[model samples]
Target: MKNDFEEKMADIMIGEAVTALLDEGVAIGWAVLTERLRLAIENETDENRVRAGLRAIEEVRREMHTRASERTGLPRVEDRSAHKLH
Candidate 1:
């Protein structure tokens, strides 16, 4: 029973860590997309389309930051390099 409980708790913690990783990945993806969108806007000739793309990217970025903040319990990256896989 003791071993079983330990295994279960380990699984739970692993699940939480995985969730955090996925969440952080989403934020990273948003940052990458934001950079791309900025470049696209600059290259595009139409001002209205550029503005629309910028707005959409900003909204996605806002949500990503918010969710990452809540999940990590830190406004910025809580840890730059740290992960255990086994």
Candidate 2:
């Protein structure tokens, strides 16, 4: 019975971790989308498309920043070295 309970608890913890990871991934994806959208809007000749894309990108960027802030409490450290110029 004790082993069974432990296994169940472990499963629950693992599930929670997976969910958090997925949320973090989604946040990161939004950041990437924002950058790509910005590039596309800059190169776009159609004024309507440019305006719409800018609006969309701004929304996505806001969401990404919010999600990123939410995930900041997670147990992880930033790898500053990876972003440093050589």
Q: Which candidate has the highest TM-score of all?
A: 1
Candidate 1 has its poorest 10 consecutive residues by lDDT at 76-85
Cα lDDT tens digits, model 1, 1-86, are 75555445434433443455567774435566556556655786765555565565655567688788889786544343354355
Clashing pairs in 1: none
Query: What C-alpha lDDT does candidate 1 achieve relative to the native structure?
Result: 0.56
Every model's TM-score:
0.46, 0.45
Report how far off residue 27 is in candidate 1 (Å).
12
lDDT of the structure predicted as candidate 2 = 0.56
lDDT of 1 at 64: 82
Which digits, one per residue and each the tens of the lDDT, describe model 2 over residues 1-86? 75555445434433443455567775435555556566665777876556566566655655666667568853212444566698
Give the clash count for model 2: 0
Worst ten in a row by lDDT for model 2: 73-82
Mark the regions of model 1 whose C-alpha exceeds 4 Å error after superposition: 1-28, 74-86
